[model samples]
Target: MMKYILGIAALLFFSCGNKEDILLPKADRTIVKEVMDLSPIYIFFRVNGKDTLAEVNRKNSISTTNWILNIDKRLPLRLVIPEVMKLQEKRRGDSAHKNEAAQNYYSYADSIGKNLAFIPFTNVHYKMVKPKAEVIVFFDKSNKIWVNGLMIKNDKFKNFINEFIDKKSENYQFCFSEDLSFGNYIQYEIYLQSLKINNGQEFIN
Candidate 1:
């Protein structure tokens, strides 16, 4: 499903194919505005410990039935993006592709195009480096907030969600859904309440 598009990418790096039968909105849409208000509602959560960006992605995939929080699409360069970007930036100094840095750089660039499918669509996922359990805060590189793929940063809302989870159910899981009736939509949040998660847990209908 399109909703899990970001989550799956976050979980693991699976290379399928460059060519797809994705039914992109066929409007002479020369320019699709990166409308902040029009962005998808990203759901992000924090468990107990500190983890790398790669680990966080895995958690997101595991908690497919959990709830979420939204953040702007624009991510901070100081975060994971910088490391990935640096991989490429350092390689530019190489006069030729004979250096290890250059090879790694080019490999990273190719991997991005193959892996970060949602980033291009403006869905930037975010995770806290050192998480504070009580303090549920969102991260942003700049003031410009858009709904990319990051989690929420509001204290009040974050607390509210945590409290809601405590009282409602133990599984603080959820996933996004779209209104296909219009062939497009404002995303809908689906919480996996009773459905048991298994090897095919994600196959829930």
Candidate 2:
């Protein structure tokens, strides 16, 4: 009778441990699409202070007529091209903006990495750190970072590192600062959503 009781207790303990592990929170892989106004969408590209609608279509393989019509149909497509292009141009104008931010993160990570080099820390993954001490967090973009399993802003961290494929190498410094934190031991995460699309295919540039 004593042996049977001990066996049952061991089994129960193992079962509970497995249950806890299974219940651990994980990031969702769903892409939340934001709504935008569908109207006279100005479909034009500029090169050398000239409207290059034809050139944009030729270079980007984006058909303005088809794109406009598809918008009219309310298809499930994100207008990531023109928006991304505009972002690229802006980044080019401010060359040091990205490098400066990246450098700051790397500097901080070097300090921390050296100190905690031997200590094994779980659930903390560093993505990018600049020499200037600007750190980019991976897991912060997901809903898992919040206590309630909902997405919340971390104002403490000076930046949130978002990953997007750049085919043109337009936005090499892909990370951006979402929030600011002025302390050591920053906590965050990265959430991988749906497969990234480039030119209507899963391609990362």
CA-lDDT, candidates in order: 0.24, 0.21
lDDT of 2 at 100: 27
Candidate no. 2 TM-score: 0.16
Off by over 4 Å in 2: 1-78, 96-99, 102-205
Q: Specify the highest-TM-score model's number.
A: 1
Cα error, residue 94 of model 1, in Å, equals 1.6
lDDT of 2 by residue, 1-205 (tens): 0010111101111222331100111122212121122111122222356322211122222211111110111110122233424433443455544332211010011132221101111211222232121221222222123312334365522232133333343332222222212111122212221212112111111
TM-score, per-candidate, Cα-based: 0.21, 0.16
lDDT for model 1, on a 0 to 1 scale?
Answer: 0.24
* Shift in Å, residue 128, candidate 1: 17
Q: What is the number of backbone collisions in each predicted candidate, taken in the order shown?
A: 12, 29
Task: Give the top-scoring candidate (lDDT).
Answer: 1
Give, for candidate 2, the lowest lDDT window spanning 10 residues.
68-77
